[model samples]
Target: MTEPVDEGLVIYWRPLCGFCQRLLEALEVAGIQATLRNIWDDPEAATFVRSVNDGAETVPTVVVDGIVYTNPPPDQLVIHLQQA
Candidate 1:
């Protein structure tokens, strides 16, 4: 079994996705630490994203404190981070 990531946000994304890039930049600007998992590089990350998104490999799939968010806006993500 794979070891769980117990801290920080896990970001499942693709390299060419503009939204993914934007979100990463926003997280950086907000000083939020995130673990970036490129879907194209990691099959497990892609599978996890697909599992959350109706079997579709959706980019910008973020996991925060065990909650999944698909394409969430930067402000919303920051809110969640703040709450955490």
Candidate 2:
């Protein structure tokens, strides 16, 4: 898959992460468009997540307009989406 573009939300996640699922569902419910990148499936994505997460692979890492947020609450994400 291609690297995420700079214009929209990009979520770095992993399988079996409840938080990731929750965030995805919330985004859908809120009618927000975001690109979902599974860390397990993309080595570059995993590395990016690690770079911001103290060298650990953390799920629900979100990038929006070049800003990074780790495990943000759904409401917080919605606010950011609206701002964008």
In the range 11-67, model 1's lDDT, one tens digit per residue, is 889988999998999899888988889989998888788878898988898888777
lDDT string for model 2 (20-54, tens) is 99999989998998888899998889888888889
Best by TM-score: 2
Model 1, runs deviating above 4 Å: 1-4
lDDT for 54 in candidate 1 is 91
lDDT of 2 at 28: 92
Tell me each candidate's RMSD, in Å, in order.
2.2, 3.0
Ten residues in sequence with the least summed lDDT for candidate 1? 1-10
lDDT of 1 at 84: 75
Question: Candidate 1: lDDT over CA atoms?
Answer: 0.83
